[model samples]
Target: MSSRYSFGGDEHVFVEVSEEMSLEAFFKALSMTNAVRDAEISGVTEICPANASFQIKFDPDVIRPDDLLTELRRLEDIADRAEATLDTRIVEIPVYYRDPWTHETLMRFRERHQDPESTDIEFAARINGYSSVDDFIAAHSGAPWFVSMVGFVSGLPFLYQMVDRARQIQVPKYLRPRTDTPRLTVGYGGCFSCIYSVRGAGGYQMFGITPMPIYDPDQETSYLREFMVFFRPGDIVKWRQIDRDEYDGCTADVQAGRYTPRIRDVVFSLEDFNRDIDGTNARLEETLYAD
Candidate 1:
């Protein structure tokens, strides 16, 4: 589909690459945004990429709105012709599924769930055609997910799995929003997976908890020293399942200022992934974990 452009008042321009979410659409958005950023377009204050769209904040005084729209159209054409490649990083996120903390929280909010008797994972597993919660967790942690958007909360990443549409896991949010969700809580809603960056009100189905922090105000860790937010749109994330012992160990490491997440720089290609989903994902994980 052709790109659709719209004006957001006089300061922002919104572009929709596709009505639905797909890697191709995201790549297109990323490509166009990167090109505009590289050009150092005058008056462009911020370039934000969403699930399948992007928006640019600018100063109309420095560059006329019509002129900026023309430039964006030009950039969109350039992006269409450019190679389908993304310069991004793969980050390993450790999660302890069905942990006691989140389990208790879910139990307390059971009446707000579709199945008050069953745990969040149990209900999710049953609906997804899995026989047990373990099977559901296995399916979830089996594939890597791409960060399509980072919002709703500071540093919270909305992740879409790098798999065929049929294979994607889908879940519904709580019947009522929870008053409190623990920081680093792993949640799922619709077709996206999310990690809560802070303890706050949430409606997503709570599944697990991560030991490391995704958002730090003080920027204490080495990883957070450069930026308070760890994730950006287009970053690949693999959720690694860990036991309570390992979770505690990682937590201790974080407290001691010694925890560093597993990360690797790799060029993601939409063409290659479209051709071979499993092969591309294997290569991505291997590259990220390689010694």
Candidate 2:
């Protein structure tokens, strides 16, 4: 697929890799972004890679927009020829599904939801043909997710479920954005599931909350001491369902700076994943637990 590069005013160059979202598109976008970052293009300030696109912020005074675009085209070709693989970390996040925190927040915004009478998960489960909420939760936690983009809010991850397109869970954003969303709220919108890094207005349908601090401003947490943001665009996420008791225990650990997510370094291959999605994921998970 040909990439369309357009200037975002004078400071940013937006490169759209595809008109639609797909693993192929995301991989291409990521590959190109990686290449550009490695090239260390002069005057380039930041490279932001999204699901099916990427953006480069630069100082045009140092590197002309035309010149930058030309360099990007060359890098794009290099990326196209490179092997489609990622050496990234898979992190396990324990979630308390149907937790009281997100439930309270969603109830307050029921009028803004598609079904005022039904809870977010209830509505989602019904429309998605799940026999019950338990079944829906199972489906959600069954597959790993890829961190496609890393900001709707600081440190918030926009995750694409790592499953075949036909098996993806889809949900609509609220009719209107909610004035408030609890921090660490596990929310889903469209084909993405996100962990709300901090409390603020949001439109994603709330499912639950995680006790682990995904975004630590103070870098107080053990895992976050190296980087305030716990997730990156290429990280993998495995969801583990937890009860309220387990959630409370995790909360205590977080308070004591003793909580650390289960993480495993993995080499993900697009070809291998496409060949055996379930087996690949199973091996990855086994490595995580075996550690």
Candidate 3:
């Protein structure tokens, strides 16, 4: 079970947990190690019952495979009993997807999907598990949480598992896409779980747009550093919804440069664009939390 951990060409650790192994047990085994040694460990779980496997990756420069192996070997039992803890944080972002113009804008987006339905504010709140937009944003407080494999679009991160209530978002029926949709708009009929970072046509029903810049090329590191979003693997996310005024103000702050682009802190290089996986784009996970 421990033999599957490998290193990429650039020295990134890649470990796969097969169907036979238990994920809970694997994470328990991983938890015995020091947090510092767990540098940049993030990967996805292939949860098919017949083919369950978790792919883990880490920075090789900070940790050696031999050291990792040794640590795992020596502390395997301890790890198996320890709990994996995630460091979570909350970020407040203001966005304006609820503008009155959204009705028309959404209509345009709906044209791309067959029988695309209009969404009411109450429905949006319900899907996000909030009674109101204010309540929605307020609940999304704490450390930034990252989840795996939300669909990606235009180099923007689409995070998942907003909440159990949010998991029921419906897939669009239409097969064709609209090219005129703005990138900042929320797609999938106000699913609010996904976001588009740039201006482009998409098939997902968009609910609104956040004023914040989803990516920055000038920073030393951007959120897209390795195409991951705000949170690392296994982190939890709390989502909230806010009113139009709050969203407008947030955009104003970003436009005025008061709010730094969080994506810049993790993005590595624009030069690496050529090496990025094709069609795997990202959008910043937009939760309407104010603080």
Candidate 4:
């Protein structure tokens, strides 16, 4: 694939690896950024990997922009030859689909949705060929999604499912943006899924709410003690549907500082996943929830 290189300014180099979002593109970007970080390249201040691209911020005074670009090209070549595997973590995030709060919010914003008469999930289900919202939720929660990027808001993860392109879920954003979104609300727009990191303005079609906080500035819980944000670009997030009782219990645990998200160490191989998507995913799910 041809990659386009451009300068964001004198200190930043942006590289778009692909026009469309794909696991391959994200893996390439992540691998290259990791390699650059490990090399400890002089003057490099930051490396940010996105859905299909990456940007490197550097001190142009110490390393000329042109020289940095050349080094980046060399690193990209090396990354292409490396094994297509990632050492990462799989995190299970609980979600309450059709929760009362989000339902209320959605109802209030019906005029902003494509179908003013139907709920967000109903409209999404109709367009995606699902018979009902229950079927849609089943399909969505059935697969694990990779954290392709963490942006739009700090700790807001843009997720792409591990399934093939044809099986990927897609939804359109609201006809008009909503003035408020509940924190930890799971949303879908375009080909990406995201968890609202904070309660703020959002346009994504809201589906559900997760009780856990993705971006806890206070870092009160064990999981967020070390890092305020729980997700990384390559981490895997599996959304499991929960009942209202379980949701309330989990919320209490979070408030009491007793909730720790289920997480497991894993090595994700792009080659294996591409070869046998279902098998790989089953194995991943097993590994993540194993005792």
Best model number under TM-score = 2
lDDT, residue 174, candidate 2 = 100
For lDDT, the strongest prediction is 2
Candidate 1 to native Cα RMSD, angstroms: 1.4
How do the residues 12-57 of candidate 3 rate in per-residue lDDT, one tens digit apiece? 4344444332324233323433332443333211211111223334
**Whole-model Cα lDDT of every candidate shown, in order:** 0.92, 0.93, 0.42, 0.92
Worst 10 residues of 2 by lDDT: 282-291
Report the C-alpha displacement of residue 235, candidate 2, in angstroms.
0.3
Q: Candidate 1 vs candidate 4: which has greater TM-score?
A: 4
Off by over 4 Å in 4: none
Worst 10 residues of 3 by lDDT: 44-53
lDDT string, candidate 1, 1-291, tens digits: 579999999999999999988878888888888999998999999999888999999999999999999999999888889999888999999999999999989988888989998888888899999988888898899889999988887989999999998888999999999998989999999988999999999999989999989999899876798999999998999999999999999999999989989999999988899999999999998998899
Enumerate residue pairs that collide in model 4.
Answer: none
Q: What is the per-residue lDDT of model 2 for residues 1-291, given as tens digits with 9 covering 90 to 100?
A: 889999999999999999988888999999999999999999999999998999999998999999999999999888888899999999999999999989989999999999999999999999999989999999999889999999977999999988999899999999999999999999999999999999999999999899999888898898889989998999999999999999999999999988878898999999999999999989888877885
User: By TM-score, how accurate is candidate 2?
Assistant: 0.98
In order of appearance, the predictions have TM-scores of 0.96, 0.98, 0.49, 0.98
lDDT at 250 for candidate 1?
97
